[model samples]
Target: MPQPYQTQAATGGGKDQEPTIIIGIDFGTNNHCSDKEKVPSAIYYNEKGEVSWGYSVPEKASPLKFEWFKLCLLDEGDIPQNLRNAAQVEAAQKSLRESNKRVVDVISDYLRELWKHTTRNIRRAIGGQLVDLSRFKVIATIPAIWPAYAQIRMLEAIEKAGILEPRIAGETILEFLSEPEAAALATINDMHTYSPTNMEAGDHFVVCDAGGGTVDVITYTVTKTDPIRVKESVKGEGKLCGATFLDEVFQTTLRRKLDKISPDAWQILEENGALSRIIHNDWENGIKPQFRNTDQHWLLQMPTSGLNRKRTHDQFRFSDIKFDAKDVQNIFKPTVAEIETLVTDQAKTTKEKYKKEPKFLVLVGGFGRQPFLYTRLDDQLNRKKDQTEKTEVLQGSGAEPWTAVCRGAVIRGLELSEDTIESTSRKPNTVVSTHHESITHGFKNDFVKPFKTMKTEFIYSTVTTPPERCDETVKRLCKVRWSSVPDFNSLPTWINPIGKVVRRINYDVKMKSNGVTLDFEVMYKNRVMASKKIGIDYTCCGSAVNQFHDSDEDSGDD
Candidate 1:
């Protein structure tokens, strides 16, 4: 049973009120660091079948530790689904389904371990016995652009992991939020520390959350600062362009070099996991954050244990290989371009729709602090420095960039607990800081027309595959951006928009296996913003049509 905490608000005798701990699990694709607010997302399964998480899990414990498991849900078709490789992934996929392993099942296993271990460190965080689960509030940040079902699946996974009981009727102990949105809340509240210029009400800015797996951008104009709140100024944009893609480019370049040295060496390197170890180690330590030099080339050392015992750089043993400036540039060029495109797209849309440009572009997430990345984006997006043109790109100082999402999540959970306390029968006179009431919420900007409209129910196309049950139907929601005013008389079952379609969030429950899946496409002028699989009886929380709220739909960008 989920019961509100009886804190100082309930009984104001003790100096220390048992804190409502907000534990944010950053379930990253490459790393899972929650015990200390950040850790390698790697999980290892031992021979006895017990699981060990965080990078500290012994290397010898498992020959193949699961990394990039989060990437399995991407289904973008650009990246390979089988991160562990084709053969191993194939067998595991079969075993996974047969064993009833959903994606969240693997995620839950890691989080369950994290939850059990967090108790040891909870005293240092907020100081309270960690016996009861209800004493704490847990929040897991999801990528802003993930499908609605993915969010639901994450909650389901959390409940299954024994962190919280699955809530069917009311508000559960856990809640879902966009990673970028969480970062924005963190940034806006902490503007005094990060922003160059203090932002005022009605001042607009963009939040660019660049992480290992995705880059999510959403523009907002400050609506109020009496406990900060804002309105969505533009449709948020999320791209697959992230830090891991740069690692992929580096991997490709490394493989190309390795193949030239000796194909056998590359094969042996793969078999022994030497190449991967070298690639990630070199990238993370040697090149990634510190690769700021554009003029000079650096050298990358090869693993001494691999089959190609002989180093290729100078035909000497145990020597370093040349990774020239060109090689580094080649590895970064494509990813950098993708990032520029996303930022520029947001900027262009901001200018086009709002008539006034944004004042700041706040970058947060693991990759947000990359100097090279910051330099390029600042050079491109920050076109002005003087008061007239003040838009500049900013990142968190110190560890703020990497930990903003989780920190913001913590702030959110704390606030929720405070609200719960205030609502109690016996409320203590506890004064909270003005910043404590930072509540950020908004309805999705629904698309509507000004002219006369005809209303009709749209039935989706039927499926041809075998039905799992007699009355099974999947609802697919599509986010669309329209290029021009669409003809309501002849609406296309699928959306065909003319403008920038930010993202089309498709649910992972494969439409191929099911016989009857209803595809619900949500359109904004020229873009398909979101799509998802839903049961036949699923209801929508927001609508695309409204007479009273239609005026607010036009973004107040300036």
Candidate 2:
């Protein structure tokens, strides 16, 4: 028998070292997964302070249970207006306050559990000897529409969860790819059924990742097909119209109907877990995915104690509530409409840029697997009576819909590690550097001249044509600062004409872009003094800084 959870290699080094193993983690709002299997994103804490997470969580709602906590990571202003008043969000927030935990802390705890299970599964598949001896590389997926600050918080949570412990900095042990990009990679690489075998180099396709909490859309134009290379045709767009919101709407509808029939019964159901069972077990697992505009009626059984009591309403004759096809359609209308709008907008943008519709619209994610959603989009895109050109809609194959993002992340990690050539390789979207500058500052002894710290600021504008000079449209992105300079005292000093000792230092400010992120570095004589990465927010032009220093100064000039 093989030993379980035993340490093998101290460090992965040398030519004979084991190959790096790629692990992809899709940290979703409703569920989290590493491979084909997924666990609920819910977490529960007992009175003794012990915690349970994922699949171990109870099916019914509990006061100690925390669900939809992922959305709490967004600032108040960033949350969708409709979701602001959602009961699930309120419950999660209450749980956080009761537990005295921050959103990042909760997420970190949950990720720790996910990592343990993922590694255990890997060990079981490949055996302990190979697993312990090999190095691990993680590729995590994030929402495309998340702001820079949110992404930073996610990274902090991932770091706190100890997922990056095996590898040192600058070794590419961990990387984050946008959800839609990952979905596209999985769909194109693994789904031979929908993969465009005849797709030409200039052909374009759109990927719509409709998950449990967010729906993200992006268009990619193929540059090569032999080894599969593509680039973003337009910036991606996303919204909070996911499957959970549909559940929220359904629950709201049920409550309204119940209140009208019997307020006392509604209260009793809420006090118990009957309402939760109906929503989670009956509607979510059964009705939502199967409803496809068919004329079918669903009779949901209600608790006999309160609902069976005699009432004036004729529909209350039986201890059940009836939901017709129209009722289900109403529950799905608002959320599905939002998703349709997002996909349509992406299609329009792709057409504007490429002068033709995308050849295919590939759908991937847990929500994307819904037959109703696929049928709706198929009819709208391909069967429209007013349009002469139609775009084909394809569901991702070769991997479970919910696992596509994680699988694609693993595929990307493998590609990056194997591709050795400088050119003719699949790479991330090109990020062009727009600005560069060099600044020299002199500090006199009279003005605190130790040169212990230095600061740099990055500013950006979203306007198509930015003003030549800094204006109201320009916003500060982030600030990068470095302290405890090792060579500060070695700098040559001279006496100024005013008889004050002066020290001057010159450094270059360089900006580098990686995917949707921008990195700024202050370099002194080929040595990195300070560096910071800022994620680009495609949704709006707002001030979001990932500052490296605590102090806030207007300028770096002295």
Candidate 3:
């Protein structure tokens, strides 16, 4: 039943309120949400001069190609190494700015078109009801590796969308859930369908999510105790080592081929239609139907017919290019080796900690969709399992790894609504200043005499001066204001006493100087304290002071 959106009281009591449309937007550079419940990371312009998605563009249409455009914008540096054309590069730069224009701009314009096309079936399947666009809660999934500052920027962009207007529900409103967690959840849901009590205590489950930008892993121990908890022990994380990386490798291979065959035509293709973008788009789609068959002739499909006539390039044009699967294998060997090593190491680390062999390893993501990838993974895991009898490799469809993550996030969100922390029954998992002032310095042997103990006020000054410079000393004092009394005596006296309060603290300290530097250390009336050294640098004057000391001077000479 579709319900209206409403806010729940902080006390946790709420009725059967309307289910505000909860939309999960997975902003992968290679994929975007295309439908109500489906998102493909691709965008295409249609014949109507409008945008379309998840489909090939028609020849009659004036199309603008966008693949992993969201991820492209995150880069503050030059364009990707694969792209070298001045014109296409300029166009891509312009598209990136347009894609990021306004959150709503993308949504209402390009994204909405994709959504309408893709979600037509989903909406029909779901009882012929349409989403209440006026009041939907938008939840986006972001890469966990993004810096804290970057995550905040994404949130700010979403807020500017004006969709979550008026009373925004905290946590439940707009949130960024980790991608792998969502994928793991989706996998668990599938696994549970067959065996409700399948994963048991001490059973280890390894999850690999290979997406547009990164490959992330999460290993967990499944327990069948009362609540059936799954606890995460480790997270294998890295940037999109998936299709995008492969695109780069393929482009380099083509570039080398072009150089060998015809450099003149290569320059033309470089200017007009670089095969890099086409390969990148194809790779991101999780299929290279042509690349799969080594014996068959794969089309380079460049824009110019004149250049095609002159270029008898190896892979650049269909000039009876005779390259075997071995050639493609050799080209991708580095990336394949890297992927294998990362997965193997992550699995080994988890297995070592578990003591027992892992029962199942679940692979998900765009890269996981490759039949070849599955074969390779299976072989690797089988070899490892050969040494031990307990381990097994369980295979799932690679076509939709993100589904698990989205389902899991939704389930998790529902769990939060009921005030339950653990959904062990549903899935096999257990998921989980101030400164002081005041300073005292003491010197030993010979040089220690001008002032046994030196102290200055004004905390946080690290300037030093000569002993004769009394005029250089500056005093700093701070007043106290508190609703309640603070225990200043309990605080350490070694630090210059400021003032104390029940709720806060304040302090003032002197600075450090040469020949017995004055280091101002302070303790506030409250619980706050800090130290600052105001003194002259003796190194400039050739004095070798091992440590600086604070001087107690009312004033210091300039």
Candidate 4:
């Protein structure tokens, strides 16, 4: 039902065709951003059946408001139990029940609105008909610890939202990058500038993406210095402890104190939506960011008349409730401790693997900039007496901390496009072809022995749990064979430790999506050596394996 757009090289579009543009989207639980500026991840449906979202949502609480719906994409078991009872989650669940909409539908609706704004912003920046004529390559960031199914659901929502609606299958590529990876890409350069230790190849660093609804931590080992390529040192870990939890804690504490002083005042505020307004305006926007462990005081004015009961306490006046440094610190303690634990664990993992602490611990995200959070992490993690032994704590430079993930997503897309262009330029004379869908899984092999033929067996399984080996649940999909082998004498050779000459030919077996079927290709040095298309009896599900082996020994006919 979706309309297909023309590819960059499609006929009829002449010299007026614009170059492809890359866009990065970070869809967070508390906020969403396509660029440097973020909008709150809140949506509201008015009584008149009109919808408003993000910054347009009303300041007053409404029964139709929806927040924290992003986590609803995950299976119930995947969500942390503590977050299940959060106010935003409860409101979203209620909204879904009343509207008879699924989580994907809600997500799609929000994304559709976001895309509209993103396109407008793009047109304003570049001008002309560039937006319509240019092919778009979108890189969306997802939490590093999200399961594969959640990632797939996110892709589906993006497609349904019309972001990829007018897309020519493989031409308009939509790729997913881990949030920590994206954040690292955007902030690592800044880290290099501020870090005391000189960053170099093989040096490891940890990226802690402490956002609104989740804190994800990952360790990366730098592979290249110039262009900055890194490989994951360990599997990333994450928890539901984020800045939003601080808001909840503060609100809960306020409610408890208010009820103890005057239950009538608390009831009046709740009924009139004054409580929600105070939390959003005074706490979330003001006190949460400004808290710095110093003895500072904050006053929240009570808007209801029921608070005129003349309550006299050091922390409370007749018309307002007072919050001191200790009150805000208490609200931040649990959440900050959780984040500290996550970062410490990642540092410990890196130390165990590489025999030293991470060279730097880079923090990025909306919450990553909080003075209290950064101060606590630095004090706890970098307390080493020797400066060289300490892991340098670096905050994302200015607003870079807030937009790092989305910006990093764009950087990743550009890198991929550059790689593609570079590869094509190297083999200008060769006819390069791409399948309808992008490659998903690929395996590389090195050959030291000469062979006339090579055969690869493709196997698949539908079981929920992956098999350790090719067992009963695993079925053979098909076999691809390369019959005419390239010349071994022309390939490069290297000497082994035993002084034996070895010819090493590296090739990758890549599988591309083609609706219900799959197209497989065996590539050698970026050149397609062999390819095969196979039909599928089942939809694309579960895991796959490509077993490679030589079909025949060297004939010695050379």
Best by TM-score: 2
**TM-score of each model, in listed order:** 0.60, 0.70, 0.53, 0.67
Q: 1-558, model 1: which lDDT tens digit per residue?
A: 011122222144342343345566667765555543457666766668788788666644234355555645433331233233444344434445554555567778877887677655665444544333224546566765454345545665677778775533223345555566667766776773455247777677888878776677878777665555666666666666778888878878877877778766666666766666677677776788777747877676655554545655554333455788788887777877788888877877887887667878888877887888888887777665642565778776544322333333232222211111110111221222222233211112212333222111211111222123222222222222222333433332333265432322111111111111223333444353333433222232112212123232332111
Better of 2 and 3 by lDDT: 2
Candidates by lDDT, descending order: 4, 2, 1, 3
**What is the Cα-based TM-score of model 1?**
0.60
Candidate 4 Cα lDDT to native = 0.66
Clashes of each: 35, 0, 84, 0
State residue 209's C-alpha deviation in candidate 1, in Å: 1.1
Clashing pairs in 2: none
> Clash pairs of candidate 4?
none
- How close is each model in CA RMSD to the real structure? 16.0, 8.9, 15.7, 11.3
* Candidate scoring better on TM-score of 3 and 4: 4
Superposition TM-score, candidate 3 onto the true structure: 0.53
Write the residue-wise lDDT of candidate 3 on 1-558 in tens digits.
001122222233343244344556666655554442324455565446566656553323222555444543333332234332333335445664654443224433444554345335445544333342223455466654332223444554455544344643233355555566556566666676567677766677777776644566667666543344455555545544565566666667666766776666566665554444455554434234234424443444444435434544534342322345665665555655666776777678876776665677777765655556656666776685357644455656423423333233232221111110111011211111001122232211111112222222121111222122122221112211122223434423232234322221223322332111223334334332444432322221211121235342422201
- lDDT for model 1 comes to 0.53
Per-model lDDT: 0.53, 0.64, 0.44, 0.66
Of the candidates numbered 1 and 3, which has the greater lDDT value?
1
Q: Which ranges in model 1 have alpha carbons more than 4 Å from their true place?
A: 1-11, 14-16, 36-49, 52-100, 123-134, 146-148, 165-172, 192-197, 262-264, 267-277, 306-318, 383-388, 401-558
